[model samples]
Every structure is written in C-alpha cells, then in structure tokens.
Target: MSFQGYLKTIKEKTGKGPEDFQALATEKGFVRDGQLQVKATEVTNWLKADFELGHGHAMAIYALLKGLKDQHSQ
Candidate 1:
C-alpha cells in the first residue's frame, strides 16, 4: 500500500492521525521537540504493544516520527 493508504488505514483502525501519534510519542518520550529520541525498534515495539499494529504499519509510523516520510505526502 501507499504511504497515505497506510496512514489512512491506521487512522481507520486506531482513530488517530499522524498528529495524534506524534502527541502520543511525545508523551512516551519517544519524540522530543519534533525529533525522535528513540531507535526505530523501540518505536515499533511500542506501537505494536500499544496499538496492535503490524510490523509494516508500525514502521510507517516510525518513518513519520523519524522524518523519513511525511504525513501529507501524496
């Protein structure tokens, strides 16, 4: 699936958008001042445990957190 597709599906499943995830990450200290403070594995692990997201979906969120992918991308 495309990046946007993945994000849309995630939102449909979790009722959360990238901004919401970012806020959650911030609360968890995974992100600080718009920068990711943890490794991708740590972020993915948290997503998996809390969100029940699959590996790929978790990675998509990780990409967003790390600035590797943009939430507004086409």
Candidate 2:
C-alpha cells in the first residue's frame, strides 16, 4: 500500500491522525536525540492486540515511525 494508505490504516487503528499521535510520541522523546531504536517484535504484538493491525499494516506503522524519526535527525 502507498504511504497515504498506510497512514489511513493507522488512523483507523490508533483513532488519531499522524500529527496527533506523533505529538504524543514527541512528548515521550521517541523521536528526540538521535537514533530511533525500538523493539520491533514488541510493537508488532502491541499493534496486534491493541489495534487489530495485521502484520503488513503493523510493518507499515513501523516504517512510518522510522521515517519520521529520520526526518528529525537531519
């Protein structure tokens, strides 16, 4: 799916748009400092349990997070 499609799916699951959830993440420092290191398996499980996101969708979220993190690094 395209990036927009991934974002839409994330909205449905997270009940918030990218900016909204991202603001929360930023407050938590997930996108601060430099590197973005997270437990992929843990995120996968959380998405599955909390949002009912399938593997592909969950992976998309992971990609989006990584992308956003990268944007802050530069």
Candidate 3:
C-alpha cells in the first residue's frame, strides 16, 4: 500500500491522525517539540504493543513523526 494508504488505515484503526500521535508521543516522552527522542525500535515497539500495528505500518507512522512528508505530497 502507499504511504498515505497506511496513514489512512492507521487513523481509521487508531482514531488518531499524525498530529494526534505526535501529541501522545510527546506525552509519552517519545517525542519533544516534534522531534523523536527515542529510537525507531522503541517507537515501533510501542506501536506494536499498543496499536497492534505491524512493522511496516508502524514505520509509516514513524516516518511521519520524524517530519517526513508523504511521497504524494512531493
């Protein structure tokens, strides 16, 4: 699936968008001021355990959290 597809699915499943996740990540100390303070594995692990996301899907969210734009945006 495309990156946006993954993001869409994640929003459907989690009821949260990238901005929402960023807020939660900040609350969890995973991010600070829109920057990732933890390792990708740590973020992936959190997503896996809490959101039940697979690696690729979790990575898609991770990419967004790290300030990467969707390919379609380019």
> Which 10-residue window of candidate 3 scores lowest in summed lDDT?
65-74
Predicted candidate 1 versus true structure: per-residue lDDT over 1-74, tens digit per residue = 99999999999999999999999999999898889999999999998999899999999999999999999876
lDDT of each: 0.94, 0.61, 0.84
Ten residues in a row with the worst lDDT in model 1? 65-74
Model 1 whole-model lDDT (C-alpha atoms): 0.94
In candidate 2, residue 33 scores what lDDT? 58
Which pairs of residues collide in candidate 3?
none
Task: For residues 1-74, write the lDDT of model 2, one tens digit per residue.
Answer: 66677667778777876566445545655555533356567556756876788888766656555664322221
Q: lDDT winner among the candidates?
A: 1
Q: What TM-score would each prediction reach against the true structure? A: 0.95, 0.60, 0.87
lDDT of 3 by residue, 16-74 (tens): 88888888889999988768898889989999999998999899878877777653442
